[model samples]
Target: MAFGRNKNRRRQDAAQRNEAVKGAVRSKGPGVMKVLALTLATGLLVWGGVELRRWALQSPRFELAAVSFSGLQRASRVELLRLAALTKGQNLWALDVGALERTMLQHPWVKKVEVSRRFPNRVSVAVTEHVPEALAVLGELYVLDEEGEPFKRVTPGDGLDLPLVTGVDREGYVADPDQARQRFQAALEVARAYTKEAVAGKPERLSEVRMEGRDVTLVAASGQEVRLGEGDSEVKLQRLARVRRELGARGLAAEIIHLDNRARPGWVAVKISSPVSERNGSAKQ
Candidate 1:
């Protein structure tokens, strides 16, 4: 009876151990499945990223949709459109925006450019065109914009009433040069200001404003010369404009007004040229 009881107890213990082993195996099976699922998910994500990049570069869905511009007058719409290499069928993601911007900036008239991508199928471009402030008659002929930047090299366009700048050499127009064009710029400003206020309304009011070395001279419509001295130029220009307004009614007298004096109270000299009657009387005498 004692041996049989011991055998029964051993059988019960073995059965319990077998049940515990089966429970552990069941738990480990789920853990292995979870790890396999995560690995597959990671691989799919990486593959999707690569496919997306390939599609972005090669697909035609992101092609250019439209071309637009601003601050452009001298250049026609068609001409500007032609200058841009981006067309309706060109891929937006494939284009180098930097290279395109550089090309547009080379147009002589284009001052700034902005490019943006609209997903799915659109690219937009915004451009700021250079406005010509003066006609720079350099060796190759360029239009000088407001910032004194020379751009286009075309013949003078119509309806431009700005001053014409001449005698500026090639070195003066380099990307960055000395103050060679400073004097010319000053002359241009004076001319523009004078025209805007006094002369532009009266076409032939002043014929030419010639800068000879350092001195600035103004040639009147009636063949008279007005001298503007070096330094303190704004005051000298003001004096000249005042004189022109005062004497313009008389239509530019045969006199020369010299405002070269900045400290000694300034002076104006007139060559009376002897009256016609006096000349006649002298002839009779």
Candidate 2:
């Protein structure tokens, strides 16, 4: 009976040990699962970070693919195209707009230029060209645009029908081009006035235009000299036109007409024809 009790006690202890082993195995399985889950999450995070970086790099961000140009004068399409070609394929976000503007302004024909970027691959450029109003005969003839800025050198045989301006002082020429332009503008205004009157009447009737300080002197077709004061140009022109019309209608002749005084009636200087005695003496009889 005692031996039987001892063997039963041993079997009970063995069963308890086996149960403890099973519990340990179950606990270890959950710990391993947790580790695996953590590892998987970490791997997923790494992969996502790499993908995000690649997406950022590969995204079609703003790059210069198209260049638009405007405000260009006197520059041909070919010249403008050449100027724009330098910025092709450049990243618009990283591009230096000021630098690009300077580049265009460096071109011979470009007077003023502006550069801007459009999103997703476009660059826009606007430029103004120097237009010449007169031919400035320096070392070489340069065409002075309306702004009086001299731009290009004139070549022999170039058929630019521009007015000639002489007697520009060296200081005026060497100073700021804007100053030169101002001179050119004043001269251009005078020339335009002369041209308009000539075109309306007999073109050859008006000869040369000589500009004095705030004054213009004109030699008419009838060898009469006229003086006009500056400003009130339109009013002066109207008065001159009336005088010419009256003289033509009446067959009246004068050596001079002064429209300098708008408040007074038209004034004239008469040159009496050579007396009959003097004419006969000079006649080739």
Candidate 3:
């Protein structure tokens, strides 16, 4: 009987061990399945990403269709495209916008530019060119932009019917560019103020703006000169027009009008040359 009991005990222990092994496997089965599923998903995502990129780059749908340019003053579209090294039928996604902008800036006229990629295979470029404002006589005549930068040498073929800015020479400009720019800007300011006023009921035309060391002088198209010392430019210009009108009423022509009175506002000294007698006299108002 004892021998029979020992055999039964061994059978029960073996069954218990078998159950424990089965339970452990069942607990780990879901974890293993989760890992396999996660790996498969990651592989699919990577493959999809690569395929999408490839399609977008190489597909005809992304091919460049239209290229639009705006704010181009002197730069032609063909020239701009040549500078950009870009053409239509190329892939839009393949073009680097920043590289193209930097390239376009080398056009010698473009100052500020923005290149962009539009949706559905379109590219747009917006450019701002340096506009010619005045002519600077710096040994060699050069063109001055609005920002007082002397950009290029004046050519005969260029339509440079602009106001002449004198007094800042090439030597002085090369020595101190910042100070030279201030002189140019001062001349331009006088030019701007002169454009607003009329003389003797006719439109005032500016021929030259000369910066004469802390004083600005304007020579009109009619050979009349006006000197503005430092500040109150617009007011001085208005006063000049009034003086010209008063002189015109008396049948007298003003050779020069001095408004350079910092101490005395509205004080003007006029040099008159009578057209009838060619006599010159000084008048203060």
Look at candidate 3 and tell me the lDDT of residue 280: 50
TM-score for all predictions?
Answer: 0.67, 0.56, 0.77
Candidates sorted by lDDT, descending order? 3, 2, 1
RMSD of 2: 12.3
Candidate 3 residue spans exceeding 4 A from truth:
1-43, 198-201, 262-265, 274-285
Residue runs of model 2 more than 4 Å from their true location after superposition: 1-63, 84-87, 155-159, 175-182, 192-209, 212-215, 218-232, 246-265, 269-285
- CA lDDT of each candidate? 0.66, 0.67, 0.85
For candidate 1, the lDDT comes to 0.66
Sorted by TM-score (best first), the order is 3, 1, 2
Q: Give the alpha carbon lDDT tens digit for every residue of 1-285 in model 2.
A: 999999999999999999999999898989989999999999999999999766644566755677777876566656665665554566666677777777677677788888877777787777888876667666667877777667788866446766666446546678765665666677777767777876776533554455565576666555666667556555666667776677768675555667676455355333433345765554221
Q: Which residues of candidate 1, in runs, are more than 4 Å off?
A: 1-43, 57-60, 156-159, 171-176, 199-207, 220-224, 248-256, 262-265, 270-285
Q: Count the backbone clashes (under 3 Å) in each candidate.
A: 0, 8, 0
**Global CA lDDT computed for model 3:** 0.85
lDDT, candidate 3, 33-121, per-residue tens? 99999999999999999999899898999889889999987778898899888888989878898999999998867888899999778
